[model samples]
Target: MTKFADIKGFVFDLDGVITDTSILHGTAWHQLADSLGVTWTKELGDGLKGISRMDSLEMILKAGHKENDYTQAQKEELAAQKNTNYVAEVDKMTPANILPGMKAFLDDLRAKGYQLSLASASKNAPRVLGKLGLTDYFPKIVDPASLKHGKPDPEIYTKGAELLNLDPAQCIGLEDAAAGVQAINGAGETSLGIGDATELGAADMVFADTSAVTLANIAKHLD
Candidate 1:
């Protein structure tokens, strides 16, 4: 009964999938690390993808050998501050910030009556979508505050499918990170990775970037 053609919903990860907000996230984390005298590295920032804010902070603290240096309250404050820094940059985004081909892809999906949902770990997903003029595309965004687990756990993707009133088997999930691909796969959705095939081998399909993620190509594969 679960035909591949039954894919009627899409669960999207906001950051690299719809747009490139990694630099903004990096800037925010770097600013926080500097304020705490913690050395920041690109690798650390890269590892933060598809994870929750607090988890990212924990990784940063461990990297700087400062994991035990802060109380829970202090850590929460630091996370809030980093969000403040990130939001400052997010506020500058516009529809032009949407990745090439992504808007067209979303339009095609919508025109076909496919439902869309957001499964980003960022609490700022709605705001970022708004800035990118994509708020109307995804009426259902899994609230990060409502989740107990982050990507690689499947909870967010499952919740996204639930919000779309579809089974995970009836959805295709797009992601740009390994953890996100894993989450989609774990939720039983066909996973499309917007990155190198070697890096995202677990995905059901891989595209070099958003430009390559066309509905036609996906339909070709599904056929």
Candidate 2:
């Protein structure tokens, strides 16, 4: 068994991991770019990975050649509006898109008595989770306001470990973003990378996506 404090507790990232909202985010950025007359593409939007909504706006605006024009509050408003648009677009996502294996894995962990928490950079994370009806799965959610720093900086992961009352070494972090993977490692927990290999490189081990993630794989790390 894993020796990490509350070896049963799990910290999961929201965007690319638990929900398929990244695509929505990409579409929103693309829409923003179009309105701003900027060139937007998947590659251009890729850098938004594991970032806050406000930061994403700043980045997108920078790409639009108006970086200095958007003030802090304006950025916040745009980010919020972008979130609104993104959510409306994603309202179509059903149980069909919450990733094929995530529910089963979470249920299995719950059966084993593990505490589950959500760590996400999105300020709109609560709404996202609420929309998906996944609010109950994570009683402990560490949102952007919960910490002074975001992913790749590790404050979120560190806060999750603290909230779970577990040693950093014993906790495990799951993320699909390169920045989040770095945050997990920075927080001193075993990082479980999902999706891209670059993100997984920061992890002690990796899964291609939620479908590839399994309780068995988690057990391997704990062992």
Clashes of each: 0, 1
The alpha-carbon root-mean-square deviation between model 2 and the true structure, to one decimal in Å, is 3.0
Whole-model lDDT, model 2: 0.78
Per-residue lDDT over 1-223 for candidate 1, one digit per residue giving the tens place of the 0 to 100 score: 3445788999999888899998898899999999989898878888986566899899999999999999999999999999999999999999999999999999999999999999988778899999999999989999998998877999999999999999899999999988889999999999999988898999988999899988889877777
What ranges in model 1 sit over 4 Å off?
1-4, 58-72
lDDT (0 to 1) per candidate: 0.91, 0.78
Scored against the true structure, residue 134 in model 1 reaches a CA lDDT of: 91
Model 2 earns a TM-score of 0.82
Worst 10 residues of 2 by lDDT: 1-10
Pairs that collide, model 1: none
Q: What does candidate 2's lDDT look like per residue over 1-223, in tens digits?
A: 3454446567899877887787887887777778777788766789996566777787788777889886788777777778777877777666666777898888888887887788887667777777776778888888677577656898999888788887777678998877888898898888888887763776777887788788787766656
Q: Give the runs in model 2 whose Cα sits over 4 Å from its true position.
A: 1-6, 50-80
